[model samples]
Target: MTPRSIDEITARADEFADMFEGYDPKPGDLDAPVPPVMAVKLAAWRRDVAERELADAVRAAREQRLSWREVGNAIGTSGEAARQRYGATA
Candidate 1:
């Protein structure tokens, strides 16, 4: 099968969220394996969400004039390393 497009993945996640909307999963439900197709869709959805969140955080940090040194300290990394990883964008 072909890989799903991002829009398709997001739609699938939205559908899945609706399935469990306003309900918490029990322990067994949490550990249950979703259908393989759903699993793939969920993984894609999760990755997209994480990437968006990371980008948003970077933008916010930059907007706040947060330095790599401060970010690194908060994340338990060295100032230099954080600068190397995130300074260019900031």
Candidate 2:
């Protein structure tokens, strides 16, 4: 894998953050009318993007020789949990 520059990493992070902007469904809005089917599709698409980004990050961390424990710590889970979730996919 080619090493990413700090700029590249920052850009990707920004893009990931942008993915969640204005698209999250609010629980308090349950009384509001149901959203269009397109909203569901968009939410699924966002989930897909997030999953791919997570796999890529896991792969990158592994390449950088970071231990599963470290990766898990960063992600707020146990090493085994992190490995089980992303190891094969990464």
Candidate 3:
């Protein structure tokens, strides 16, 4: 599927927000878990956020002259793996 461009999303943002804000769910629905597709999307969004945050941290750590082994240990990986993953970023 093609991703929506930023402008397309921006244009629809207010409409989406209005629809979301207008919801009037039944009392029982208040305690319900998210739908399966929403759950999957939420998980993907979390992972993307985590990846960006990790890259930012790794960039900072490299700027502080931290060793790849140290960074790897902090992130639960081997030094070589860390180097290969983020070497160019730093």
Candidate 4:
């Protein structure tokens, strides 16, 4: 897959922010109901974006000669764990 440009990522982030900004619940409406499927789909979309960004970052780090240990430390995982998770994609 082609890597996303910084501009593209920024635009997407802004779009996500806008989504939340538009969804502010009314004051004192503690029991406001949201569609269950909407929540599920939003969560899935966020996960998809996160995984794509992570794969891109891992590939870039490998290209820059960064060790898996360094990547692991940055991502709060063990070196072997990072390798096992991202090696094939990187």
TM-score of each: 0.45, 0.58, 0.67, 0.62
Give lDDT tens digits, candidate 4, residues 1-90.
999999999999999999988987778787767699988998999999999999899989999999999999989999899999999988
Candidate order by TM-score, highest to lowest? 3, 4, 2, 1
Badly placed stretches (over 4 Å) of model 4 are 1-33
Sliding window of 10 residues with minimal summed lDDT for model 1 = 51-60
Ranking by lDDT: 3, 4, 2, 1
- lDDT by residue (tens digit), candidate 1, 11-31: 999998988896877779878
Candidate 2, 89: how far from true, in Å?
3.0
Candidate 4 C-alpha error for residue 60, in Å:
0.3
Residue pairs clashing in model 2 are none
lDDT of each: 0.79, 0.89, 0.94, 0.93
Better of 1 and 3 by lDDT: 3
Candidate 4, position 19, lDDT: 94
**Better model by lDDT: candidate 2 vs candidate 3:** 3
The better candidate by TM-score, 1 or 2, is 2
